[model samples]
Target: MDSSRGTRIRRRVTLFLLLLVASSLVGTSRAREAQPLPTAAAGGGSRRAPERHGLSLDFYAKTCPAVDQIVASVTAARYKDFPAAGPAVLRLFHHDCFVEGCDASILIAPTAAGAAASAAPTVERDMEENKNLPQEAFDTVELAKAAVESKCPGVVSCADVLALAARDYVQQAGGPYYPVKKGRKDSKVSLAGKVRGSLPRSNSTVDELLRVFAGKGLGTADLVALSGAHTVGFAHCVHVLGRIYDFRGTRRPDPLMDARLVKALRMSCPSSGGSARVVVPFDVSTPFQFDHAYYANLQARLGLLGSDQALSQDPRTRAMAQELAGNKTRFFQAFVASMDRMGSIRIKKGRKGEIRKVCSQHLLAV
Candidate 1:
C-alpha cells in the first residue's frame, strides 16, 4: 500500500477501537443506573451505614403485633385534644435521639435516690437545652407507654414507642408518614450533663448547626430537610428575641429578615418586659401544618430561628433551602430520609440498653 493509504488504515483501526471501548463503558453505566436502589432492609440507599442494629420495619411483628396501632391511637387522641402535641412529640424524639441515640433517656425523671447520689442530680429532662421540651411531649410518651405496657408488658421499649409516636404525630399534623424501624432500647443512663452541647441552639450559625448535625453523620441536605419540622412547631419568644430586636447586638433587627416579619415579631416578642412564656408559630403562613412553608419562610426571611434562616443565607445550604421551598413532595421525601438516618444514630443493642416499664422511671426504680 502507498504510505498515505497505510496511515489512513491505521487511523481507522484506532478510531474503531476507541468507539468500541466507549460503547462498552456506556453500557456499564446504564446497567448500574438501571439497577434497583437498595431499600431500608438492604441499607444501601442512604449515606449512613446499613441496618446492622437489629432494627426492622416489623421488629414487633410477632412479639406485640398491635404496638403500632396502640401508639398511634394514643398519639391521635392527645393530638385531637391539644394540637401542640404533634410538634411537642416530634421535638421530644429529636432531643432524645441527639443526646443519647434515640434511647428515650429524655423521658427519665429525677429521683430522690439519684439526687442523694449526686450533689445536684439532674436527668436529661432537666438540662437547660431540654427545659423547654414541653410537658405535652412527656405526657404523650407516658400515655403511649402505659397503653403499651398494659398489652405487651415488657415486650415494647420506650425508645421504640417514642419513635413510633413521633412518626404518628408528624403524619397526623399533615406531614409525610414514614416507616420507623424498631428494636431500639431505652438508655440506662440519663445524665443532664450529656445534653449540654448535643442540640443546636436557636441562634446557632450555619457552621455551628452543620457541625452539630455532622457529628451525627448527617450532611447539609439532611440538616435543612429536618429543619422543616419547624413548619408545625412554635418557638418561644426568648428564642427569637435577639433576631427581631438587636441582632448580634447591632441595635437593629437582622437585615436578612423581611421588614414585615420584623414588625410582626416585635408585636409578639417585645424587646423588654415580654412574658417569657409567650410563643409564636415557626411558620406564620401555615402554623399548624407540616409543609414546605418553613423553607418558603426562610426564603422570605421569615424564619423564626436564626439557625433556620441561616440555611437560606449560607451558600452551602441556600440551594437546598430554595429547592425544598418550591417542592413540598421533594421536601417530604428528604425529611423522611433524614429522619431515618437520624433515628439510627448511635443505637444501643445487646445489654447496653433496656426496655423501661415506665418511660419516666428506670426499670430498677419501677
Candidate 2:
C-alpha cells in the first residue's frame, strides 16, 4: 500500500479503539454510581446467582473451615476460661476492618517517620496488645489455620480466614448480616510500612481520610460509615491525649460537650503523651457492641480521632449517624451499605496480581 493509504488505515483503527475504551469507561461509571445491593438467594430472577459457575467451592471450603474452628475455639476459651478478653478481641477486628473490607492491616507497626527511621525497630507494645485489648485474636487465628492444615492439609489462605473471622466477629456482636466473597489469597509480602501508610491514624484529618478513600475510588458516605467502627474500640493515651491536653488550641473539644466529662477525660488522659494511665477506650461504656454508640459518643464531643469528629460537623453524615444511633435496623442497613462501598475500593487483581500464601508476609513462590 502507498504511505498515505497505510496512514489512513492506522488512523481509523486508533479512532475505533478510542471509542471502545470510552464506551467501557462510561458503563463502569454508571454501574458504580447505581451501587445496587445484591438480593437474597430466594429472590431469584434474571439477576445472576451469588456464586459464579467457574469459582471453586472446594477452595472456599478449604479456606473457610479453619475460620469456623477458630471462632469456635475462641468463643469457648473466652466464655469458659478468659471471658474478659473475648469482647475486646471481637471488637478489635470489627473496628479495624469494618471500613475497608477487613484487611487485617491494622495490626502492622507504624512506619518510622523520617530521620529517626534508622533507629532500632521495636513494636509499640501498648498499641497492639495493650491491657485493654488482647493479642490472642491474631495468634489464635494462625493456630486455628495450623489445626486446619493438619486435617485438610494446607488448603486455606489466611486472607480468607481473616475475612471470615471479621464477618463472624461483627455478627456475634449484634451487627449487620455480612456478605463476603472468599478466595482472597494471603499476601506473603508483609510490608509494615505500607500497611501503616494505608490505615488512618489517630490525628488524621477528615480531608486526609477523604483523599485516602478517593484514591481507592470511594466517596464521602463510605468514609463516614467506616468511621462508625469507633463504636467498638478504644484509643490509647498516645492516640487521643493530644486533643485533650496538647490540642492545638483550634481543635479543642467542642463547647457543647459536658464540661465535667471533658475535665474528667483530660484528667484521666493526662497530657503525658502516650501515658498508660490516661488511655481511654473509644466507646468508653460499651466497647464491645456494634451499635450507634460511636455516633452517640461523637454527639457528646467524645470522638477519639480527628476523622471521627469530622462526621458530626458534616451536614450529610451527622443526620445519618444520629438516626442510626436511635434505630437498630437503620444502623444495620447503613452498616451493610457502607461496608459494601468500602469493600469495592480498588484492589490488586487479574494477571498482574499474585495469590499470596501468607497473610502477614509476602506471597510465596507460585
Candidate 3:
C-alpha cells in the first residue's frame, strides 16, 4: 500500500472511533433525561427528610469548627503513605453504615459488658462478613479521631469523624468533593449477630441487591451508583472462588465473566487449595482510580464479582450501567446523592448515642 493511503486509512479509523464515542454519549444523555430521580420509601411511603435527623453540612460549625480540616489532614497524610487507605476507608464507611446505621458501631471492640449481654461476646468487626476489612481503614479512623480529640476533645463524635474521613478519602482519590452532613453519634451496641442479613454478598443477583438496598431506604440508582466504589479496592479469593471455579455447581466458571478474566483469575485462585488471602482488583483497568471505569468493565463483562456484572446483565439496570459508563459527570453526581442518603440511615442523636473519646471502645467500657 502507498504511504499516503495508509495515512488516510489511519485518520479515517480515528474519526470513526471518535464518532462512536460521541454517539454513545448522546444516547446516555437521552436515557438520563427520560428517567425520573428515585426517592426512598418506607412501606410504600416517602422517607423522612435527612434534615429531620438533625444532620447538617455545618453541624460542627460552632462546636468543632476545625473538624473537617482535621479529618482531611489526617486522611491526606495517611493516604500519601498508603494509597490503599482510600478504598479501605470507603469500604469501612459502607460497612459501618449498612449495619446499625452510620453510627460507627463497626469500630467498637468487644467488651465484657457487651459480651455478658449477648449469647456470644463478638463485636461487629470480628464478624465473618467484616473480617476482611483492612487495618488501614481502622487506623485512618483512629488517627483522625485522635487529631480531632487533640483540638476539640469530646466535641466530635467518632461517627462524624468516620463520615468526614470517608468523604475526604473519596475526594483525595479523584472522586467528587461532596459535603458530609455531621452530628452522628457512636452507637453503644455492636453485636456480631446483627451482621448476617444486613450486607450484600459477592454473588448476589440484581434483584437480591435491590431488595437489600430497598430495606435500607435506598433505591436501585443508589445501589448501582454505590457499586461504582468497586472502581477501586479489591476482593479476596475466597469471595470469587465459587464464581471462577464451579459457578453454582455448573462445574465451570461463570459465563458472565470475560474469558480472559476467567483465565487470569484461575491463575491466582486455582480450583483446589488456593490461598484464601489472595486478592484481585475489582476493576482491572485502573483499579486504583475512583471513576466510571467500573461501569465500563461491567459492559465488557470484565466485572470481577458476580453481583457487579449483574448490573449490566439484568434488564432493569443495564441502561443505567451504560449511561454511567458513558457519562462520568452523571455517575459522580449520583454517587454524591447516594452517599448523602446512605450517610443518613437511622442516625443516632440526643440521648440515644454518645460522643466517645476513643473510637474503638465504648465510653461505658472505657
Candidate 4:
C-alpha cells in the first residue's frame, strides 16, 4: 500500500474508535438519567431496598432540574388568580402526610375495580375525615403535578410535587419559604379503612393532636407552627357550631370561647343548621394573611374549631402557641423547619415506590 493510503486508513480507524467510545459514554449517561424509581413488585421493576431513607432537595438535580421552579411558578400563578387556593393546597399536603407518610396516597381516586367493590370500601378519599376536605385543595395538587409532568415527563413523583406545592403556596400567601426534600414515591394502595385513625379530627384534643403528630416525628412546637396554616383557610360552620352554641351538652357556648366571637359564629351558623355548610375563617382578624394571627386568635379565645381551642387549653401547647404569637420571625422559622420534617415522613427513596405517570392512579396493582 502507498504511504498516503496507509496514512488515510490509520486516521479513519482512529476516528471511528473515538466516535464509538463517545457514543458508549452517552448511552451510559442516558441509562443513569432514566433509571426507574422502585414500585410495587412487577415483572422487572426496580426492587425495594430493605432500608428506607428520607429525600434530598437535589434528588432531581440532573434528571428533572426545574422541578422546584416548575411547581412554584404553577402554584403561584393559580394562587394569584384565586387567593383561597393557597390555604386549600396547604391543608391537602397536611392531610396526605398524616396518612401513609407522605406517599401520595390521598391523591388517589377510586379505580373502576375498586369502585365496583360496593360490598366493601376501597378508596381512602371516601373516608369521613377526607370527604369534607375542600376539593380546591386537591385541584391545586393536580395543577402542580401537571406542570411537573410537562417539564420532566414521568421523573418526579406526585407526592414530592405536593410537598413542593404546599411550600410554594405558603410563600405566595406572604408566609415563609421552605425547602422541600424530594424523591417520594406514589403509593399503590389507598384504603378507606386506613383513613379513620390516621388523620387529626376537628374536635381532637391537644393530647390527641400531640400523640398523632409525635408518632410522625413532630413535636409540640411543630404542631403549633403547622396549625398556624389555619391563618388562611376557612372552616365549615358545622365544625365550629358546637364550640360556639353548645359545648359537650352544655347547650351554651364554651366558657373558654370569647362572647363576641360566639355571637358572630351564631349569626353565620344558626342552631337550626340552616346554614350548616357556611364557612368562616380560622383567623378572624387576618383571614387573608398566613402569619401568627392564628396563634393570636387562640390567645383571644376566637379560635374557630374545637381543636384550635384545645391548643390554648393545654399548658404545654399553650406555651408554644404564646411564644409563636409573640415572635413572628420565630414562628416562621419553626414552621419552615417543621414542614421540612413533615415532608420527610416515611419517604420511599432510592429504589422504592414509583414515579407515578398520573398522580391520581397507581402505576401497578397493589
Candidate 5:
C-alpha cells in the first residue's frame, strides 16, 4: 500500500496493455494471411445462390412487402441532392462484395464486444483503399437504413439495404434495372488488415484482376462489365499520379497513354508535385452519365487508372473492352449479370449473423 508499490503496479499494467495491443495486431495480420480468398461453387461456377443460404428476391416479401420500393425512393431522393451519390453507393457494394462477400461488414465500426469475440479490433472502412470513399455514399446509406427501420423495424439487414440502394442508384444513373436478392445478415467481423490483400490494386495487370474476380466465379467478361461502374464516378489524383507522372520509374508518362490524353491530364494534375487532391472524372466524355462511355474512353487511351488501361492493353481483356465500347446494349446486359454475381459473393444467413440496429456500429451486446 506504499507509494512505491502503487507506482510499480501502474507501470506493470501499462506495459501489459501495450504488449496486448501489439499481440492483437500481429495475430490479426497472421489470421488474414491464412484466410482463403472467397470463391463460388466447387466446379460449377454458375450464377446460382450458395448452397448454405437461400438468397431470393422474395426473401423479405412477407416481412417487408415493399422493401424494394422503400429503398428505391430513398436512394432517388438522395441522388437528387447529391449527383455523385450513384457511384458512391455502388462503390460501397463493390468493396463489400470483393471482401468476404456482400455481408455489410464495411458499415460496422469496431466495438469492445466484437473485438473480444473475434479478436479483431479493426473495421473495413479504415482500410487505405476505402479512405477516399465519398462521404456522400455513407450518408446516403445511413439515411436509407433509417427510413427502412422506421417502417420495417428490425426486419431488414443493412447488407440488403446497401445492395438494394446500389441497384436503385444504377437505375437512377440510367444503367440497367436488375433484380437483387435479399435476406443477407450483417457480419460483425471487419478487419482493416484484410482489405488491401483482398482487393485488386490499381497497378495490377489484366491477369491479376481476372484472377481476383475468378476467385468469385466471375470470368474475364464479367470483369469488363463490372469495371464499367467507373462510368459515373471520378478518381482523385492520388490514384492516378503514378500513371500520369512516373510509370515504371521511367520519369515519363505511361507509354500506353495517348499523347493528347497525357497533355490533358497534366493540365489537371501538374508535373509539379502536390495536386494529389485534385479530382477528375473516370470518363472525361461523360463523367456524369452512367453509360458505356467508360469503355469508350479506354478505346481512346484516356483511362484514368492503370487498371483501367490494363483492360485495353492486356490481350486477354482488351477484346472484351473493345466490344463493350462498341455495343451499348451488350454492355448493359453484361453489367447487370456481373452485378448479380457480385452481390451474391459470400453471405451470412439467418443464424450466422445479426440484423444491425445501427449500420455504423455492431448490434449491442445482449
Candidate 6:
C-alpha cells in the first residue's frame, strides 16, 4: 500500500477507538446519575442514605414529650370547653407536610400576601371557622411538647413535635409508616396569604398542577404521588366550588365524579357564604388517617378535587394511582418512595445551600 494511504487508514482507526472510549464514559456517567437512592432495605427501590443517623427520629421523639405538654397547657388555656384542642394543633403541621414534603415552612411562613399567619392555613381555616377543627389532634401534640420542654428545655421545636405526632397519628389510624428525618431547624418568618397561592387548588387543571409541582422540581409522577395525600384530608365546599361553577373554563370537575355528590357539594357551598353552612374535609370518610381511601374514592368518582380526579386521565400517573387503589401496601410503598423523591427535590445541599433561619423571606434569608 502507498505510505499516504496506510497513514490515513491508521488515523481513521485511532479516531474510531477514541470515539468508542468517549461513548463508554458518557454511558457510565448517565447510569450513575440515574441510579436510585440507597434505602435501608436491599433492592428497596432507589433510596439515598439519610445524612444524619437516627438523629431525626431521636430528635423527633425527644421533643415530643415537651410539645405534648405545651399543647395541653395551651389548649387548656385557650379552649377550656374544647379539651381536645392540643392534638388537633399538631395535625396542622402533619397534614401540611404529608400533603407537601416535610418542609416545616408551611406551618409558619406565608406563601402569599394578605393572608393571616397560621399553621396549615387552608385546612385549619375550615376547621376553625365552622368549629370543625379536630381539637383533639392538636391537644395531643401540645401536651406532649409541654412535657418535652419541661424535661429538655427549648431543645425540641414545635416543628420536630409535628413530625413525630404525624408519624404516630398515621400508624394509630392503620396507615403506612411515614419515617421522620431530623435536623430540620425552625423558621421564624411566617407568611399567611402565601399558603393559598402556593397550594394546589381543587379546581386546578392537570396542566396547572403539573406547573406547580414542577416549580418545586417535581414531575407528573411526583404530582400524582403527592396527590395521594388527598387520601387523608377533605375539601370544604368552598374548595370545590370553582369546579361546580366551571370558573374560567379551568375548573371542570371530572365527568366521572358522581353527579349527586357534585350537586350536593354545590348546594352546600352557597355563593354568599365565607366558609360557612357547608364543609367538606379533604378526606371526609377518614380525614385524619393516611390510607388508600382517597384513591379508592377517586375510582368511585368521589374524589374531592378536580385535580384529584384528573389523575385518572394522565397516562403517567393513572397507573400509579390505580396501583395504589388496588392495594394498600402498594400505595404505602409508593407514597414513601415518592416522598423520598419529593423531599430530595431542589434541595440546596452540601456547600451548595444554607440552612436559613426563616423560609418565607428568601433562600438566603434577609
lDDT of candidate 4 at residue 25, scale 0 to 100: 17
List, residue by residue over 1-366, the lDDT tens digit for candidate 6.
Answer: 124532543354344334434434111100111222223232212333322312334543644434443433443443234312323443465344433334344433323544343443442233222234454444444555555556666455555555555545445445665665554444433333334444565667777776656544556656665677665544456667766666556566446666655565554566555564344545434444567767666666667777788877666556656666666676677666655544433222234323332222334444
Which stretches in model 2 have alpha-carbon errors above 4 Å? 1-134, 249-257, 340-366
Clashing pairs in 4: 38-353
lDDT value, residue 311 of candidate 1: 88
Candidate 6 — what's its lDDT?
Answer: 0.49
User: What does the lDDT read for residue 198 in candidate 4?
Assistant: 76
Question: Can you list the residue pairs that collide in candidate 2?
Answer: 188-361, 188-362, 188-363, 189-361, 189-362, 189-363, 234-281, 234-282
Instruction: Quote each prediction's TM-score.
Output: 0.85, 0.65, 0.86, 0.82, 0.82, 0.59
Winner by TM-score? 3
Tell me which residue pairs clash in candidate 5: none
lDDT of 4: 0.73
Per-residue lDDT for 1-366 in model 1, tens only? 124532543353344334434434111100111122123222112344423486899889999999999999998888776777789899999999888688888899866665475785678877778878888789889999999999999989999999999999899989998899999988989998888888999999887886777667677767888899998877888998888889888999989877766776776678999888767777766667887888877766677788888888888777777777777787898889889988988888879999999999888888
Among the numbered candidates, top lDDT falls to 3
Residue 71, model 6: Cα distance from true site in angstroms:
9.9
Global lDDT of each candidate: 0.79, 0.49, 0.81, 0.73, 0.75, 0.49
lDDT of 2: 0.49
lDDT of 5 by residue, 292-341 (tens): 87877787676878999888877767767777777777778888877887
- The digit string of per-residue lDDT tens for model 2 on 1-366 reads 124532543354344334434434111100112232232221112322111212233445644455455545544443334322334454454434323334444343344578775673433222433234456565545554555555555555554455455555566666775655554433223333333445566667666665655545555556666676666644556666556655667667645444444565665565554357333556543555677677766766656566677677766456555655456565577667655544433322344234333333334422
RMSD of each: 19.5, 19.9, 9.5, 21.5, 15.6, 22.0
| TM-score between model 5 and native | 0.82
C-alpha-based local distance difference test score of model 1:
0.79
TM-score of the candidate numbered 3?
0.86
